[model samples]
Target: MTKNERLFISPLPRYAYWLFLLGILISILLGLLFYRQVSAMVQHQAEAELKRLSASTSDQFQVYLQQTEYGMNQAATEQYIQTAIEKRDAEVLNQLLYGWQQNRNHAELWAILDKDARIISTLRGSSDNHNPLSLNGLALRAMASANPIVSTEIINKEELARVGRNVSDRLENHHLLKQEGVLTQLVIVPVLGKNGQVLGALCGGLVLNDNQELLRSLFGNSQAMHAVYQDKQCIAYFTNDNKVSFPEQISPAMTKSCILDGQACLGQMQSDGDTYVTVSRYIFNAQNQVIGYQVLALPQSQYSQLPAWVANISLLTGFLLAIFSIIVIGNTSRIRQLFDRERQRGQESYYLGMFAQKLQECTDENEVYLLLKKYLSRDLDVIQMEFNIISADDNCMESIRFTENDQVSRVYLNQSKCKPVLTGRINIYNDDRDLHCNQIDTDLIKSHVCIPFLAGGKVAGVVGLGSPQEQYWTPGRIEYLDAYLNLIGPTVTNIRLLKLLQAKAFEDQLTGLKNRHFLDQYLLEQLAIAERYKTTLSLLMADIDRFKLVNDNFGHDAGDLVLKEVAAVIRAAVRESDLVARYGGEEFVLVLPNTSTDEAVSLAERCRQAVNSLQVIHNDYSRIISVTISIGVASYPRDGNSLEALYKLADSALYLAKNQGRNQVRTAQEYLATLQRTGCDD
Candidate 1:
């Protein structure tokens, strides 16, 4: 044979070709396995992230509902609300409801319903011109359960009008109105009398269809899509750009699998020829019933592209290796570098996930800031960290700084440096000169970044991190910082909101004293303590004499002034250890621990004398009015053993004092003797 043919036909060369082909096949199989593993992992991570976002959105919705209910409850306890309901005054109800609705920006519509479930007045407009809003199912349920209710079932204008007409026509129909339409979520809370009787229901509506700002704030303004489904139909939808739109009546299979089943569903769906990985969760009402579904869609192209590229690169590398086996040995270091980069990325993700989990466990702003500082300083090698909390009440910035020496210092940031942050924008400083602040340590800090903590589309606070080295804040680090702030921002806002709600829950807004809720809780706790230690516990119940006359003569405004003055006097007369609460309309209760009935009588007398000496100048009438309060004193173990018994005895004594003229302090025994004398005279 010829020389060229002999070299080509050599068995050694043939074996090498077969080996090369086999190696190519093996590499293809390995690439397929790698692609599947990576794709599954990426999908899982994406789903988890989406679920977290959905959960956060759900929590924000709940908080909004809570705030609305709290505002309604506060309004329900207002003196004006009670007065308007008692006198059936629509004008007064409208004024009170409108003012309350304006004060609470979240309230869309405010209405006051009578005990018979008839709408007495609404802030929407005049009751004569606008038909009364019917008591919807949510309101009825809330009234029945004596708890707040949140419902997402939409009720349109026409249907509401029909229900209102039916309610008016029946006159005696006390059943809940059965109406559903396209309206939004409603939060209904019942207004209760002093004896815990449901006097009326207060309803606040949140129209979600046009509430783009709220949806964007809750779902995040990013490349993430969100939709709200009611009755398996898309009622509201938001795109990745935060634009509000409604999806047409097309039934999505995922809705049945996820919403109807009440389970979180994750899968891929094709829409408009583009693939998307969708995650759906059931949105529940305050009654713990599934009201609707919330769907989050992410483009599959975004995640799948990386894995596809990785697989192609593996295949190309395998082909090159088969062609040049010697080159593989030389490129080992390059392969190791790629592996190391991936490992670093994975570690960063793990750390971020861990930090987010820890952050969610924090319940206070200070704790959140401290946790952020610890993690940022340790993970990112930050030299100095500072957090500025924006006070919504005062419009001031309270700052906490952490130094390299592990020292924490609290300070205040000036208005100029905090303006940009308070404007809800991220400020990046490549050098210390960019930060025009006296608080910045220019000598120690070379670079820094400031990110705002946003909540409800507003800046709640700002977080800053500094490094001694130049160019230390990279793009990746900034992205991680953004993630951290996003998680902690809502948390801080929630904590502050909860704190405010807690204060409101126990306080009387009108009189600025503790309310009946606080009175009951504190009285029970003190009574338990008194019983355990065999200590004396005295109770005093005081009522304004002829309070209705003050309201009827001088108007409700004057009555409010009198109540405020009485509360102030009562608070002044008692010691700091004593507990004073506005029990109800024209009534105040005091719990005196370790005190006898004599001490209680003296305190009550002092309070009455202070009120009698005061000249309450009404701002509205520009007239002075004299006020007198009747008091009744009862001591634990002497008058009664239980709180209910003691309260009843004190109340009876107060009634007796009111009956025998007015303006005097009487003990439980004194009133009983007066009753006996009256019986003998009869």
Candidate 2:
């Protein structure tokens, strides 16, 4: 053949070329299948990782709330705290509150409130340096609940300063005390007298704005975090590079879904010409009410490339194989690796399901932790485990260590050793020399791994595991531990939520006093005791005087303040053995066992006097309003024997007290005598 003809002619026949084309087509199909499989795997892994991150952040946020609540509650129980509050000792109260503030480095404000929910003393921290002593939404919510409550609502310090200016000309120089639109979480605990009456409340706040460290710890440097407050306002936002400014507004639909409906949402959102996977969760108060939303946004460009890169590698491998046409080895090792991964994934799925089921049955945090320990020790073969949970009151990490010998010890982590871990990074120490173990023998532990469990973008706790052999933490083992923590993070969070719900069931969210529900149950029990012991029982019904005027002139906020103040006064006036409850709006019921009509009348007079002396400053209008309450005393046996009869007589006497103008105390007998005297004159 001629040279040109030879170059053009095929070496094989037409049918052979068709066969070769078929083989190439098949190779392309297989390559596409490989790409799809790998991409799906990567996508699943990414989702799991993101969920873990969200769960961790949520856990940390809840821990902060719990710590704050605990701190306030603990302070409320202090003898000196009650004494300082009762004495209205500003210096002593400030001293105690300042010490508390110092103990909680991040606490922005600590204040002692009188039984009337009036701020008697306060200590402001660096977070909100100029935050004035004013009633904020958080304080109101806490006082209303009458229990330790963590607020999800954000308070605008500048707006508060402006409001204060209206109330006090002295606040004019404060210059709006720029809070920079930071969101704050407040914890309030009601202080109770020996009689279980709420004497006052202790409040602590943590400001979250420009809190770069918190954001970094929550999402790492690669992700984005933002906090949305009332009206869908973006109070705080942070990105990995610190360059991306948050949008002026987020998706209102998402916010409504999260805050109003209390549903977590995850979807793709576009911002600044880039797409992001945004996840949002509701921030709830101790009353189980959603107050805000926390959002995490991850740029799609960063993670979307992973699947493309994986597919491109698959295509490249196929191309190389087609060109070489050499018999490719089966790669048994690669097959085994895939099998192992699949097996591990299956195990994780199974264990996660099991853990969720078990956790659902748990009633408290301690039970959840015990379950986690069991799973780690048995299923995961962890030799020793240590958990260091952040303590908000102490502003430090508290450690709980479980050893192989079944010994449990509580201690604190050396700050120097766990600093990095606190920043939400996984810290691995392959050798004992690199590990810091002040409480444990480092020589006995050859390998250590520290993983941080985050809440609200900050380290809430650290999970540490140790092994006696060097290099024991393989990638597979690390993956297992991470998977286990994913389950634990959400489980612990649910446990906390359950407890809050349980508490709310029995609490009165409005007055911070025992609710009518508790009153009925408790009053009946107390009455039974009084009857069994042949003791006297006195009942007092009190109602705020001219509460309608406060509500009409100053608004409901002012009216609420009046109600809380009167409740506190009544509580303070009663004995420890007495029971007090909010009977209805602007009305309270008090039960005094082992007391006569005179004693009840005297107590009612004391409460009436206390309420008359109260000067409540409106939070919003900055108007100083005076409030008073009228009380009616009724004694069991003297005025009907049953609880219903006593309540009826007290109500009748309360009506007379109101009829003879307000702010007076009247007894059932006195009301009857007046009626009889008037009838005879007629």
Model 2 agreement with the true structure over 588-665: per-residue lDDT tens digits: 999888899998888888887877887876776567898878888888778877878888889989999999998898
| Per-model TM against the reference | 0.55, 0.44
Best model per TM-score? 1
Backbone clashes for every candidate come to 1, 10
Candidate 2 residue 380 Cα shift, in angstroms, is 14
Q: Name the weakest run of 10 consecutive residues (lDDT summed) in model 2.
A: 162-171
Candidate models: Cα lDDT each: 0.69, 0.65
Query: Cα lDDT of model 2 overall?
Result: 0.65
Candidate 1: minimum summed lDDT over ten consecutive residues — where? Answer: 170-179
Residue 317's C-alpha lDDT in candidate 1? 56
